[model samples]
Target: MTTAGTPTFDDRAVVLDGTLVVADLHVGRGTGGSLELPVGSNTELVERFTSLVDRHDPERVVVAGDLLHSFQTVPRPVDDTVAGFERACREAGARLVVVPGNHDTMLDAVWDGPTEAAARIGDTVVCHGHEEPPEQGDRYVIGHDHPTIEIEGQRRPCYLVGADQYRGSEVLMVPSFNALNAGVVVNEMRAGDFQSPLVTDTDELEPIVWDEQGRETLSFPPLGEFRRML
Candidate 1:
């Protein structure tokens, strides 16, 4: 279990003070797989989310953003998928909250629950990271870049943690929760390549990968130093 101020990572989600935070669900994505298997993406999301909730037993579950994929419309299956998320959270006895992202233009159509431009949990601010957050906190947890790192010959999802990176606030950028979304490789990327205004210095950010199989987390050096090693 994590301490009150510390954050724990699991399956693209972070837990801090009895709250589970995830991002970039992109519920309506990958709809081309023969209408028969339309719920494929949804199944993956809900099942994984359920597992996370079960493990953490959080009092609250927060989706940092991109809860839906379509910008202009909300599909029927997409709506159903969202309901699944709600059901899982309800069953787990956790309050679900959403921080809408850029792609979540149709979020209101699906989610009628609590939302914030930037939600605060303790001293940390949770946001979608696509835009500047109105609120302030000592640390910021965001998800929008869907960062990844290539190790050996395989590509793996990663979290970018930067100290004093944004407005003097520590920043933690989680990977996209959706497995279907092949994330951006951040090995050589500079601050300009990132879409998040919160990311000011890529060099100061450290890439962290969670090894589910090994049940361990591997922390690499800051991107500036790690780049030379790569």
Candidate 2:
């Protein structure tokens, strides 16, 4: 259970209540499975998570959504990568939990640890953001949009945050953990551009970008405010 404090944002990880939460890993993304060109290998993902775990030393690791890719055709290599990911998580000394995403419809066939449609972490609701989150949680943390922001003419993955008018809750949108997926730039997004319906209405969402080394953080105003500047 998390105490009374806001979640801490870092490179590809949201520290919440001793849990290192990440989203949109899209394992097996290389080999023409996820991107136009190959970028990372399974070992790279393992190493990255290993570093994150070693650095944060969280009690548990929660993959908010999209742990794997290739839903229509689950390649054998992808399956192996998923298996390896689960093993890597355990080796890092953090229990792995997964939430279902649209691309993860076939995830159960690969690995099974702890799975749920949504999870309650204190006042925050952790979900995939493919659908409306439950009302019980005062705040919602989700990852389906794969948010990013442009800074100094360069685009980087970012966390989108703000109060949700429709849901009447605080909303935090996590960036895709996979380095290859650059994610949807919040400024360029249009209505229905995101899988989560809440994103379309939340024009006031603030953009928080973390440096590659996770040593610095920068924040931008809401999209509405940003658009007016342009």
Candidate 2 ranges with C-alpha deviation above 4 Å: 1-4, 31-40
lDDT tens digits by residue: candidate 2, 1-230: 54226778778778887888889988756644453225446667777777787788887788888987767666666766677667767777788888878888778678767897787778777888888765457777889888888766888888888875335777788999888786777786755677786565647788888887758778888888887776
- What digit string (tens of lDDT, one per residue) describes model 1 on residues 118-230? 87787788999998888888889999999999988789999999988888989999999989889999999999999999999999999999899987788999999999997
lDDT winner: 1
Overall lDDT per candidate, in order of appearance? 0.88, 0.76
In model 1, which runs have C-alpha deviations exceeding 4 angstroms?
A: 1-4, 31-39
lDDT (Cα) of model 1: 0.88
List of clashing residue pairs for candidate 2: none
Please give each candidate's TM-score.
0.94, 0.88
Candidate 1 residue pairs in backbone clash = none
